[model samples]
Target: MPKQLIIRGVPDAIARDGWWLASDATLPQHEPPSPTFPILGEAMKRRMPWIASVVFLVALGDLLFWGYVPGVSLVIFAWAIFAVACASRPPKRRVIAPALLLVLASLPMVEHAQLLSFGFLTAGLLVSVAWLRIAPSRGVEVLGAAALRLSASLPVAGVKGVLNCARAVSHERANGALPAWFSAGYLMRNWAFPIGGSLVLTVLLVNANPVFERAIVQAFQIDIDLFSLMRRVLLWVGLGLLVWPFLIVQAPKAAMVVTPPKTGIKLGLNAGSVLRALVMFNLFLAVQSAMDVSILFGGASLPDGMSHASYAHRGAYPLLITAMLAGAFALAARPFLAEHRALKPLVLLWLAQNVLLTGSAAMRLELYIDVYGLTYLRIYALIWMGLVALGLIMVAWQVLRECSARWLLIRSAIWGAGALYVCAFINFAGLIAADILTRATDPTVETQTDWHYLCSLGPAASKSIAQGTWPKLQIATPFWATNCLNPQPVAMNWREWDFRTGRINGYLAVDAKMRAVRDEDPVGR
Candidate 1:
């Protein structure tokens, strides 16, 4: 017999293959069937209002506080999460973790480049909290579920919520009593023809007589910018659309779907094959590590054909990419090879070597920067290398503990993305210029400064470039040619303000003014 459910006081046939009846149902008055998904039906019902309220409250606070004080916005966001915790009534311990992370991650929003990083980290936390509220005891699955929910929620939830609302409205209109204003047929019958006729008559009369058209234009000569009006409407509507689903419903539950294995392979790999691969991979990494240690660290001179800086620069990027691949392979392959006792130690040892390799990559990049001078990419590469190293360590821990590789990956990806996003907003050109200028003043240090690169750091470094005295006149020419010193000022609202831009513009304005005064009065200088 097909699975049967009483939907809307009638027995409905639900398909046998895990298909569910999604209709509204009423149980007996004496005792209702306990919710199969209590986290969704009950926990969310209790917590969603709080979550939604906090979301709007934070938005309001952002409007009021952001860019006014660099630190204040972070505090307000934290408190908004706190208020959410109180309203949801989750345990203090559970609420504290995500709340703390949100506040800390939000600190970087004071800088512009960190916005994507902040979005990813905060999205992860919000998803995690929503999952925890529904199913707090799922252990390792919580992290995976949170990852799944976050990945799914962004693109799927809003559309689903919209459909849900439409369905609700349709059902209510069809089955329940409706007010006259909401009845579509009644409205069309009563008002549609009259409104249409009025508009038609008005257009015809305006075209028929020049005098009437002039009178109408003068009477309705209000200053209305349609573009501005449309933009405001879209802004609030877009925000509402983005947040509506989250407010009305809970995120996907851990139970809604099964978590797949890291590799997704059901069949076993041969113990011999895995062992052979690990051994070969380890030997290859060993050779590379040995070479790096010898040439880069041991003071061994490079071959005549290659300069040390050139050799170092070539490997800096590729080696880090290699280490990242190694971490990924180890995570994916470890679960399959767990039966082999020897593979575990070898895997840990391999990851440790990759960490060392990452360190070597960082050293090489530093050497490259020392020779070529700093650019934004070089500085960010160093930061990324650090995160890659940390990720490798986490991968090793996952193997040692036999924890879920998926969990390790999810957490690592969150942090790595956050790091890169945060790095994006840094004023690298200004920083490089400042550092180079400081170093050039020193008589002891010997290094080439790339003034051309400094000038390319955009208007942010305008002040440093305009005022700096350089060794090469060629480098100084571009600064004058570009007129970077007096780039037009842009007025930023509180939402768009950030530390880097604020400081850059502030310094540039002051320095440009000073330069102007000094030029006008050389004797005073």
Candidate 2:
């Protein structure tokens, strides 16, 4: 029979032979078995597929495509999800969850507006997950592990259950043990086929699309192609993800065992990457707002839904700053993922993409100050957003590629996600405030409440004017850019407005002061 005795605060262990058989203190602490009570990180990693499925499924459901866009999106989203899961090399049995999710997501939705949105949401989620799984090289793995150690030592993940397993794999490698990729054929087996196939497919598919145009342009010296430009930006972003490789000199196999590290990846925790990424990400979001960038890279142009605010200047710039600053002040405290950290790797790429886009825009603006000079939410805005998205993906890719090195992906994902969600929450609040101010026709919501509110409403107000229905005035006078006195700024309405150097085409009226500011900086326009 098992023996148990309570001694004041603690329980007594087994005793025999007429005496207390005191166990050596050195013997491992009496703790839960490793199998039954598995480490938290591993458990979360196991559930990533399910979480991915849910996100994808919900997005697919939101697409709202019926007669308007042709509901082929459901099939496409399912295929994408399945393809991503397969690419992830999910544990043999894990495939079921994604498969079931794909089927469930196709459940018919009655709303017309929801179809396209759901489709987009689903596709984005699947693509993100697919991007998340790619593994970095072994050398990078070492650096990644070190970063993990340092990240953990900082007060980031413990509270939220984010740090431990959020960006799980390479984080362990950060300390010491090499992942499967370190083995001779591991690289070829793990990535070669996928990388090669993806490269060919992306090139072929993009080329096949009528709207998918690529051009070589003069930038500094060497002629730069679109692909090359994107690659350059992403390469630097990848480099930035290698934080703290030097800090953790060695790592033990036992995870959740925190150790101290002196240094970390110095590049502002991928906040720079976020700035770069936001250049494109904000643009990507903008396209959905406008009817450009196509709903699918698969085709040309997708329809825009109800959400009207384009995060052009205020959104992208603020987001970029936040992403960059988050590295030190905010980045340290959150889990490696919990979200914002998810974009850590693409810091350089994002910057480059933005630079390339801005450069391209400047070139166009130089020719026609009145038409092209002003910031417009057209193809260029989409391009900017694409740059940001691409940069972010590249950063995510860097994390995945180097997953063997830093193990930051799984752990950081949680914190990165959390940060992003928090940002989303902040956005929602601002959106509500803007809605209130739009109807209030007063300064209460704009000034007394969130100053950021005006940024979220500009595009919506522009659309209302474009449709010839002046939205119910929030203010009779120009309290902010979104007021009745002035038309939406190019920063807000530039995308959809037909533009040229001399003429302004959309709903908003153009002026000398605004046009001068818009037209002045030809180089940066």
Best by TM-score: 1
Off by over 4 Å in 2: 1-91, 97-258, 263-419, 422-474, 478-525
**What is the TM-score of each predicted model, taking all chains together?**
0.65, 0.22
Best by lDDT: 1
**What TM-score, to 2 decimals, does candidate 2 have?**
0.22
C-alpha local distance difference test of each model: 0.65, 0.39
Candidate 2 lDDT by residue in tens digits, 394-462 = 444544554332444354454544443333212232233334444444333332333343344433334
Pairs of colliding residues, candidate 1: none
Q: What root-mean-square deviation over C-alphas does model 1 reach?
A: 14.0
